[model samples]
Target: MRAVEDYANDDDAAPLDMLAALFEARGWPCSVRGHEVSGEVRGSWAKYQVKGIWRADDRVLQILCLPEVRVPDDKLGAAYELLGTINEQLWLGHFDIWSNGGVLLYRNATMLGDDGTLGLSQAQALVEIAVEECDRFYPAFQFVLWGGKSPADALEAAMVDPAGEA
Candidate 1:
C-alpha cells in the first residue's frame, strides 16, 4: 500500500479552493488563506461562520460551523447535556462545544481517500449539511441556555417540524 501523501495533488489548488469557489457562487462571503476557507452562511435561525480546512497529509476535509451561540458558565452542564442529546439525533456529523469558550458548533469531516480530490458538489453539500444541522438545533441551544428548559425538553421542542403554512 502507498502512503497518503503519494496521492496529494501536485497543483497549487487545494480542496479548500473548491469550497471558496462554491461559496463565491452561492453569494456567501468567504476568504481563503492557505489550506483553509472561512465563510458566513445564513440559516433559518441565524447566520453562521463556516471554516473548511484541508489536510493534505490525511487527504481529509473538515467543516466547522459556528452558530454564534455562547453558553454561559452556569449553563455549562446543561449545555453539555444538550450537546449529547443533539448529537444522538444526528446521522451525519456531531455537535460540539468549545470547552474554554463555551461556544457551540457543528463539525463534520470528509476523507478524500486516494485521489485526494474534492468535488464542487461535495464541497457544497458539506457546507449545506453543517449549516442545516446548526440551524435545525439552534433553538434547542437557546432553550437550554436561557429558557431554563432541560436537555430532553429542549430537544423535543426544537425537533418538531411544523405542518403546512398558515
Candidate 2:
C-alpha cells in the first residue's frame, strides 16, 4: 500500500488531474474548476468541480465533490444518506454536484444546499457506496483519497486543486 505522503508526492497527478486523464481516456473534453471557502460561520472549506463535455452531442457532465469540517457526530448518519442520495440521483445521473462544507446539491445549474456530514465510519461507508455506484453507472469515476486528508485535509483538497487551477 502507498502511504498518503508518498501518493501525495508522486507525480501521478492530483485527484482532479487524474479525473481529467480519465475523461480524456474515455474521449471526453474535461475542464476542472477549483474554489476555496472561509468565513466566520463555516471557518474554511475547499471545492473541486469537474465538468466534462461529451464529443458525441456536446452534452456536459459534472461532478462536484468536497471535504467538510466540524461536522457533529450526531449528523453523520444523515450525512451518509445524503451522500448516497447524491451518488444515486445527481452524481450518477447527468447533473454535477459541488460542495465543501456540504455536498453540492444541484437543480440544473441552480445551487442547492451542501448537506453531507458524517462520522468516520459513516463517511467511509458513504464513500464506499459512491465508489460502487459510480462504478456501476459511471465507471469513469475515480477516487484519489476518500474521507479527505484527516477531514480538514480532505476539505481543503476537495475544494482546491493541488494543480492550482480548478
Candidate 3:
C-alpha cells in the first residue's frame, strides 16, 4: 500500500481551474479558491449557487448546485420524500437536503480515471447537468415545501411540460 503522505501530498488544481474557466466563458459569476470553484447560475425558478470541488486522491470532480429554497422544520420529512421521488427521475445526479440546515441541493460527480485529466466537454457537461436538473426540479421542491403537496402530487404538478412559448 502507498504511504498516507504519498496519497495526500499529490493534488492538482487544474481540474478546478478548468471549471472556473468554463464558468467565466459562460458569463456565470465564479470564484476559485484552492481546489474549489463556486458561483451562481440563474435558473427558471431561482438563482442557484454552483460549486465544484476537485478531490485529487479520488480523481473525482464533484459539483453541487444549491437552489434558493429552504425546507422548514415541519416539512423536512416531506422534503426528504420529495428528494427520493425527484431522484428517481434523474438520469445523472440526485437531490439531497442538508441534515444540519434543511437546505436542498443537487449533487453529482464524474471520475477522471487514472490520468486525472478532465476534458472541457466533460466539465461543461457536469455543470450543465447540475444546472439543468436543478431547474427541472426546483418547482417540485416548492410544491412539497410550500404547497403542502405529497411527493407524488408535487412531482406531478411540477413536471407538466407545456408545448411552446406563450
Candidate 4:
C-alpha cells in the first residue's frame, strides 16, 4: 500500500512515465510525449498509433488509438452512424470522430485515485482495450471510409465469423 501523501505530489499525475516503464518492461516501443505516450500496434487490418494522455485535473488517464482509415468529408454521416452502432458493441472504450479533422480515434480512460498509484493490471487493461478494440474494428472503419458500405452492412460484415460461414 502507498501513503496518502504520495497522491498530493504533482508527479503522481504523470501517467506516461508509469506506462512507459510498463511498456519497456514488456519490451514494447513507445514515444513519450510529456504526459502522454504513443506507440504503434499492429492490428489485423492495419497498424495503429495508440496514444495515452493523462489529465491531472480530471484524475484520468485516456488512451486514444488511431487506425489508418481517415473519414472524408462526404462520408461523415456514415461514419457517425458507424460509430453509434459500433460503440454499443464495445464493453470498454468507444470510437470518436473528430468533427474538424474527421479523424477516428479509439478512446478509453481510467480514473486515478488520490491515494495511490494506478495498479499495474489496471494500467495494462487500459492499454489492452485500446489495442484490441482498434484491431477488431479497423476493417469496419475502412469499409465505411472507402468501400461505400452502409454502417449496418459494414458492421455486419465485420462481425461475421470467418471460420463459420461465407
Give the per-residue lDDT digits (tens) of candidate 2, residues 1-166: 2222343344342333434444444344445445211111111223222232212122222232222222344444444444453445454333223334433322221111232111223222332333333333221111112332332333334344356565
Decide which is better by TM-score, 3 or 4.
Answer: 3
Candidate 3 local accuracy as lDDT? 0.81
Q: Listing every candidate in turn, what is its Cα RMSD in Å to the true structure after a full C-alpha superposition?
A: 6.1, 18.7, 7.4, 5.4
Residue pairs clashing, model 2: 33-166, 34-166, 46-159, 47-159, 64-97, 76-118, 102-114, 148-154, 149-154
Total backbone collisions for each predicted model: 0, 9, 0, 0
Q: Is 2 or 3 the stronger prediction by TM-score?
A: 3
Winner by TM-score: 1
- Candidate 1 per-residue lDDT, tens place, 54-97, comes to 88999988999998988889999999998887788889989988
Quote the positional error of residue 19 for candidate 1 in Å: 0.1
> What is the TM-score of each predicted model, taking all chains together?
0.89, 0.22, 0.88, 0.83
10 residues in a row with least lDDT, candidate 1: 1-10
Window of ten residues with lowest summed lDDT in model 2? 35-44
Q: What lDDT is obtained when candidate 1 is compared to the true structure?
A: 0.83
lDDT of 4 at 121: 59
Q: Model 4: which residue pairs collide? A: none
* Candidate 3 local Cα displacement, residue 9, angstroms: 30
Superposition TM-score, candidate 4 onto the true structure: 0.83
Clashes of 3: 0
